[model samples]
Target chain A: MSGTLPSDSACYVYGIVPADAPVPEEVLGVGDPPAPVVPVQHGEVAALVSEIDPRRPLGTPQDLIGHARVLDAVAAGRTPVLPFRFGAVVRDAAAVTDELLAPQQERFLAALEGLEGFAQFTVRGAYRQDRVLREILEQRPDVARLREEIAALPEDASRYQQIRLGELVSEELTARARADADELAARLGPLAAATARADSSADQPVNASFLVAEDSWEEFERAADGLAATWEGRIDLRLLGPLAPYDFASQLVDARGRDSWD
Target chain B: MSVAPRSSNYMSRPSSSGLVDVIDLILDKGLVIDIYIRVSLVGIELLTIDARIVVASVDTYLRFAEAVNRLDITQDRSEGLPQLVNDMQEGGARHKTRGALEGVKEKVTDLIGGDGEEDEEEQEERPRRRTRPARKGREQ
Candidate 1:
């Protein structure tokens, strides 16, 4: 049994930081087999480090929690972080600082700068099935045929049957969401500084995160109120923010291979 | 990070404080750089697999069908299925039309990136590798 076991290697990663900041004593990195925070200092930014056993698999709920914990912990302290892509690890601290961190200093600095004093807000809504369906059937007979066909399926079915059904329903729902998005965006866009649209999940009918200015929170809420009135019960809207600008952060990298944080 | 589809839209009033989309803020769209000597990750191949769960089986279809069935039109006549389906059509249509069917690519490492690496000892707690969206997708 021991012979069959895979070998573990140390995994290193970097996470959010303020510009030209000192490393924190208790920096943590992602995984169930948690890694301690090691600061990989480039000119102004630092990559969080941990000695991870390379043989282990990452991305379990615990790993997700581990990742969130480290960044959240740092962000909570008001450190504007340039979050790294998950599964990022380096050989050692020196390489992390020189090759990874140093070269990307400008990008990191810019990212930190862009996010300063601003935060991210997430808005999610599920289709009010009862209301939406009623509205849909009343409005379009063409869709009704499809809906009627879906209704005819048995309660107990195979896995294959279910995926197909999910696909159809998802399509119908997305159609409604797109229109709803137009109306919602019209009302909500002005309130946000930037936005990222995400694919909707079964539970999350409309998944969108908005980057809003810190001072304009009240106005943002008011705008949501107006949207709620306009859409009524047809669409649901939820907002969460005044936190780190995680969503607004871009994935574009500069010449140095560092992400453009700003 | 591509979005998942199939769950029907809701009729309830939009939530005032939408924290459920929190996953969106953290998942993708962050920064990643290869600093100096790239840190040696453990079993990343396994980790990525765990994070990326694509829904493309019969189960997805049935659930979608179920949600569609559940959408009763007898109650309110103001809005019909066609109009609602039309609204959702763009969203769902894209699902079928686009070749980009990559499901849930979690960059859990940065936002939730840490010790998620699967080791032999932790396998017991982990659920089946093929979760197939199983009737219920992650609720917002």
Candidate 2:
């Protein structure tokens, strides 16, 4: 319940922040009977932690949410955090200070300063099935002809044309997705200090994240909504943000983050 | 008011709003220290479920062909396909493949002896959050 703790059970590490970072009170971290999060500080860096029983493992869906909720709540507020991968734990509070924080205090401090006033926001845009299908059919005569040919033939006879039509649609979708992703980057890129994208599919054209100054959040959301309005019935776009910089901060250390928007 | 009447297709939500939005970021991302971890992941399985639709395959092609087969593309706007579009939609829905997706929830579900995308993933809207309209014509 308090930052100060008894030296017994292992410490479950959630994230790293400045020593004085304000953790929300009564916030419980990963466990069945969740333990109250407490800070273990070393000079300017601190690890947000809670005591956990060594007998139990930490990989439950709720545990993942709990871990993220703690870090994201901090990110959503004022304090900037470098989120540690879930399931990170050290033997005791001393190990958190001596082994974790003390060894890399300067690197952690610099990363925190770099991210002091910013948070991560995500953009996901998926093509509406009905509308996109109509566009494809209208534009490609070959595709339309193939559709008709398949319809006239027996249910199983037009298998080759069916595959051919699907392949063409897939090709067209890939090209369109590339163009849309570029347009999306051009629109949202300037507003963000930095940007990173996730893998795009024919169905979902853009999966991206932006690092924006906290004060400029309203402006960014405005642009996203505008894009959504433009493609309202064609492509569905959603904005999620004030996140814990999971994308941008991947550079701080080697982690299994998502691949680029390719 | 800064907000005007917008369509039901899209909207923005906070990062804390739901697990569906950031599940991958929470699990696959963040800083990893090679130093120490005492928690035993002995029986826990890592399910790297790709939720995105795999667009290139004979089956997907067949589905796409079938979906296009339903479109009444050449006719006038209000007069074409009629209710045939609905039938095509049902046909496509019947074959919509979510083949690879099991996600962090499924991985953790395996660890705890559960079956699917658990509580938060299934709920479209959580209490105290704004109600999300059911997505129309969404790929199920």
Candidate 3:
């Protein structure tokens, strides 16, 4: 499957897996024609790839979905996959095999083996804005007093007070969010093989990914459900997973090299 | 936002439909092969950069402040101060505050000549990418 495609058509790589692993038959890759997904092998590892027009801009929602779909499909098929970052394109299948698959075969094989029975589960928690604000007001008398003072003033005249109130609220929210995120991480830490905290946004207090062994998935879910019940009305929790170990795979490959996994 | 009730199965299907979920997984989390070419994704770069621009700005602070001030007017002033605090603790207060904040956000965006609706429209107009057929028993 190498060196046959036109040079103008590059291979858009989705991920890499063991060469013996079954290719997900139904998956189509990124592009207007929706390039046929195929595997190019080197040693024990193979790259999941498809042809793409290199010149086309690739940020459309469809393109994003297409990239994710291919990777997710591989994971769903029970094969370990090391997903490539979206928009990973190469000159052609030959380059994919020679540069990506051949040179990195050992590392890829090790990473894939390490991730064999694990999948990524992302747990996102956002505060019920109102409840959090209420909690803050109850905790901070100064902020509550300031809020009252601003409320008493004329709308047009309370500009400085409004700014102060905004600053205080923002600060308090950040602090509370930090505490809550830590609490969540601590609670969920034992259930996973490894955990990584995702970048937090304003509303989301807890954005974390856990690399979980497939056997422990039930235990993890039950624990999460219990925590959700305990924090009901305070934090809204959403769990997404059984996904490709995207967050962990890249980190492991970079941090320890091929020998670390063994 | 209440948590969805736990289903019996442990391996929940991924929520890949929302734009935020897609961006979080695709752009931010994935394996990086050092030797390969990284394609310049024009729209993603633009969207991610633009999304960060409006957050935590002076406009957002003023809006938050304004919303707090408006909260006093809509609630019962006749009742004692403690009663007012009690009322704010309830869900009604949340809805009012959220609505007020959202209103201010829209107004501030309009005042700054930002076309929020046009961005949404452009996002909607982008062609839908095809996905694999839903696996049995996992359809949502």
Candidate 4:
């Protein structure tokens, strides 16, 4: 059964860190008994990697988490790391440098330098469902009326009215999300070196990642906290980072037609 | 030689992230090299398929309407003042977003990294992969 696996030379790459970036010890990689991460360095950059048995498939949740932890550990140290998308397995460590790093050495160095003294912050804000709905009711009489009309009917009977009401609410939600994203950017833009917008999922009004400098981290934190308090009940905002710059990484490396999503 | 980052008021939380945030940031938003071989990410689609909110559909409309209908507009807005403070401190969007999506198996890793990775599908056949459960909260 294991006869068809690729040669024993495969390596699972976590991401690219500066050649001088310190790899935190004891960080594990993908597998049942996880693998130990080793930096495969060439010139100015090193690929954080661990040898993987080609036979073991690597999509477990733990693998994904380990991938992020390794990169984050580096980024937390203020070193610039260009993260590789999870699930990248090259034939060997040499392939990481030959096919991945050595070829793009100049670009990776430039991107890493750009990321110095800066880290990415992600803000995800979900609408307080009940409160936002109540606000929608107060603001849109038509929606409020439809909602009321549907409330009085039997489950099957009000199907159409329910759909109509939901549609109106959806429109309001979309508009609110758009406005909130813009306001979030506007409020934090001056404090950030770069800000990239992300798609909001169900119940969320704002999802974005920002790149902020080290010295301004405190001021940015305060500003974000203030925003969270201001919209406390209406929209709950959670901010996390000084993280590996994932949003900025895509733009910095345009390999394999993977362009900037923002 | 490394300690937890107690550096700034700006980077509010530690590098530990919620499952929802982790999925959004790491699943499909990082660097993709052209010469890489991939294992089947069959289960990734399940975890990420609903990461982007699809709000315009009939099912969504109905869900929105139901969520709105559940609200008692006449109720006082200030009734939950203290709870709002808690939400600001810890119950922020991450918690609420988790509520909307299916529960992510509790993640134990303090893995830090930015918002997530690549979006392309690898052309590989699925053999043995354990994806997460079906996210059916808003499936209708």
Ranking of all candidate structures by their lDDT, best first: 2, 4, 3, 1
How good is model 3 by TM-score? 0.74
Relative to the unseen true structure, what is the C-alpha lDDT of residue A189 in candidate 4, on a scale of 0 to 100?
84
The TM-score of the first chain in every model comes to 0.72, 0.88, 0.91, 0.90
Model 3, position A248: C-alpha lDDT score: 82
Error of 4 at B61 (Å): 1.0
Model 2 misplacement above 4 A: A1-9, A53-57, A253-262, B1-10, B35-56, B72-140
Candidate 2 residue-wise lDDT, A1-262, digit = tens: 1123333356788888889988757665687678899999999989998877655645545566677778777887768898887667676777778777887887788788778878888887666565777787789888777788888999777788888987898778777877888888889888888888766567567778898887787788888888877777666677766778887775743322222211
First chain of model 1: TM-score? Answer: 0.72
Query: Of the true interface contacts, what fraction does each candidate have?
Result: 0.42, 0.37, 0.26, 0.35
Model 4 TM-score is 0.76
Listed models, DockQ each: 0.23, 0.22, 0.15, 0.22
Q: Is candidate 1 or candidate 3 better by lDDT?
A: 3
TM-score of each: 0.63, 0.74, 0.74, 0.76
Candidate 3 stretches with Cα past 4 Å from truth are: A1-8, A255-262, B1-17, B34-57, B70-140
Query: RMSDs, each prediction?
Result: 10.0, 9.1, 11.1, 8.7
Rank list by DockQ: 1, 2, 4, 3
